[model samples]
Target: MSMPICIIVSPVQESADEAIEGRLHLVDSHDPQVPVTDLGVTRGDGIFEVIGVVHGRPLALDAHLRRLANSAAMLDLPALELEAIRAAVLKTIDLDEHREELSVKIVVTRGVEGTGVPICWVLSFQTDDHRAERAEGIKVVLLSRGYPHDIAARAPWLLTGAKTLSYAINKAALREAARRGADDVIFTSTDGYVLEGPSASLIMKFGQRIWTPSTAQGILRGTTQGAAFEVFGRLGFATAEVLVGVDQLAAADAMWLASSTRLLAPVRLLDEHDVPVDHDLTDTVNAALLDTAR
Candidate 1:
């Protein structure tokens, strides 16, 4: 494994004219940086974004930054200096020696208790090879997300749409999927509506239409899924974001989990039921996604 590159961004929010380069400082990834009293560590009060890099290019950067900002607003954290964050991300990517494929993570946390300031950092590391999952596909099991489809609207404080550090439940869901002999999980709302995977977005094809569960249901708006939608639209597939019932998974021609690092992995089996794997189409979509990075 390679040593990760880390860049600390002091005073996360700043004016454009402010010297951003002065604010970004390289740090040792192996050493402890975050304080124990930080809200992000104690209460999981923070927002984050991951950007995939291919051939030295960051994928869907603008979309990722936008989502980061949205998450900040949802958490009521201080406004982020997006331009500065972008510079830091690019700098970290440039500093990283491994250039084949990389995952860049941007994290902003409500600072240590009693401090109104926020803490931020940009880290870059090599990504795992996901060719097998993309080629052979993955087995998935459906699990209840323990909320209704309208929970985001009913309980705004739940922070459904934000990409925060509170991923214990998501990790537990994956473990549960493993116990059930599956590679991943698709969360369903209490009302029987399909949600998303633990760390990926669910994209299903029914006939010529490609649909992803609406983000309105409190799922994080998938940046990679948005890029995949563009590719599907160009290929003449009718694309949409709408409410989908859990029962509808059985009727799909094909399905896939879309994420930043893995790119796209077809779901071959849903709840032990064989789901179609469109290898050629999957390759075509993956090619486009990789090409965008180039």
Candidate 2:
């Protein structure tokens, strides 16, 4: 038999049904009741946000909502009843109710209309990861699409800021990296400046400061990266938002990926090179990052 899509939510034995190409249906406390054949999801006409659930509360809830709101507005999609969605998220969290960190995702799809399929799944998943080795860091590959226009746009496009469910390109990029025997891909501009990782913001240190590409670089604004920046600055490290290349980062004292769930993980290797961590800087960055997440 062909392999079933791996979008299943393995939260303590909950079941999954295919909801869309890259998503699945799972039981929840307050899940939405959309039809399984809704074309919006079947056609990738949707938006989503993967939330970090801690202590039963989703971290950066406001930020996720803000991004979700932006994506929905851009897609000309209807406003998701926030109360209903929040309830579903919280309900899903209660399903497994584990002690370790978990992720809860919210997906909003445009219901099919006319020849289109009808609306569907506003759902959440309790994601469990045992890869604490990530605390050390992740190795990433920098691959440039020679301007990235084929797969992405900086046009006055709504999807640019929206967490749209149309992530086929994103998945492809990561696959390319895996093909190269790497864990993740760092997409660069035609000019060789970094944009972001396939699913994260870049956090590298140069001199005595922490730096990430600015929004002018045309990348998703990362909440965890930003929050950690504030905490990094308060802890006496200078922070910057600038465009630096693979080589520039290679010269940095340390590197890491910042996101809601990982908090911080050092990047011990870059490309084919083994980039060692400057122990002092790593400690400072780790302490600063985890403290803020707490």
Candidate 3:
């Protein structure tokens, strides 16, 4: 394992013409940095994006940055200098020696209480090995998200679409899955709509058609899912995003949890029921995803 590298970005929001390089400063990831009073620490008032680095390049970077901006806007934080953040991400990646497989995390906090400024940093670290999960797939249990499919429209304040730092619920769901003797969880809406995995986007395939849950259902838009769709499209598979029902899982020819770092892990078993796992197709999709550029 390699030590994580961090780069602090001062004045997260800067002019387009400003030199972003000078604003980025490399620091020890293990040392204290953020103030104890920061709202991200005190209230989890922040947003974050994780970008996977393959070989020496970052994958789906532009999409991840766009999502980060969306999250910040949803949180009512200051308009971020995306170019500056991009520079900091690249700098952090360059500073880290783990180039084979790494995950870059971009975090923007609401800053300390009483201070309106935002705190931002980019951290790059080696990713976990997901060979086993990707090859043999994972077992998952279906859990209720405790909200309806229309939650985003019903309560925008819930920040459903935003990838905020508050993830206690997601963690708890995974713990529940563990209690149920499952590897992961696929959260369903109270009204029986299939949502997504605790930390992944759910992808289901029915013959030639591939589908993922609609993002309007209060789920974060998935960057890796979009990339996977591209791969599926190239392979002559029609792709679409629609509202999926919990009962639809049993009818699917195959399903997988798509995420950064892990890439794609087929769901071999759902709620203890065996799910069809197309190892060959899974390998193809993952290979294309790993080969993705930018």
Candidate 4:
């Protein structure tokens, strides 16, 4: 008897460019040949990064790659074939030149249970909801992460700052948020410090200044947030990394969830509290993000 193969094809965007569609690259993009013994599948022991593609060009590509490398290092994985991964990313984008907005995920699995080899692959697909969320904004609810702000520093084995595949809790948090009538979730530390969103970073505004939770507070360093901050600085906005609390969020001028795919999405409501949504600021931030991303 043969093992059943699962060939999953990524969905391309309808608004993508007309040139590249209805095509798949077997070796590069889609294949159902993962070894069942791979630790990534068995134990969720791996690292990954997702980059946003705009006009066939990946936004903040280098930054995302750097973060991927960092995650690999944190996991003590074998040396990454950076050049090969870069080539694969470019090839994936080339295969879908029509993708107006795409999300390319890079995954590096700690090979078959015992093998020293690592399985690295890139998967590209068109994103559907980022545009809508960015345009209309989103509602979020704060949930306790059940840990103190300094836990990451004390428990390095927890992999709190790494983008590992063990994201069951994060997904569960989002589902819980949806059940409560919110689109996303913001995790807070037990000590009452705001950490980050399940799949994005948190950014709050105070007048013309922007603030994000410090990485030292146990949040993943955000690539898109860093890029957006650079653009914000150019636009005459000050940026800082500090410990933010729910009370501070309530008093802020506006708040947003920033990520590689969504770029910058204004938070219109937080845990039923109406957050101040500055339309003009959102537009300006969005434009700057696009320009800087390109």
TM-scores of the candidates are 0.98, 0.76, 0.97, 0.89
Candidate 1 lDDT over 139-240, as tens digits, reads 999999999999999999999988998999999999999999999999999999999998999999999999999999999899999999999999999999
- The residue-by-residue lDDT of candidate 4 on 1-294, one tens digit each, is 221111122222233453332322336223465689989999999988888888767888888878888888889997665655666677777666445667788878888887777776677776656777887889999999999999888998898989999999999999999999999999999888999999999988898888999999768899989987887798898899998876777789888999988888999999978888887777887787777646
Structure candidate 1, residue pairs in collision: none
Clashes of each: 0, 7, 0, 1
lDDT of 2 by residue, 153-258 (tens): 4564635545677888889998998898877777887776777776788888777788897756657778778777877787788898886875586687777777
Q: Rate the local accuracy (lDDT) of all candidates.
A: 0.93, 0.63, 0.91, 0.79
lDDT of 4 at 164: 96
| Residue pairs whose backbone atoms clash in candidate 3 | none
Locate the minimum summed-lDDT window of 10 residues in model 3: 10-19
Q: What global local distance difference test value does model 2 have?
A: 0.63
Clashes of 1: 0
Total clashes, candidate 3? 0
Q: Pick the candidate with the highest lDDT.
A: 1
Candidate 4: where is the Cα deviation over 4 Å?
A: 1-30
Candidate 1 lDDT at 175 equals 96
Write candidate 3's Cα lDDT for 41-88 as tens digits: 999999998999988799999999999999999999988988889988
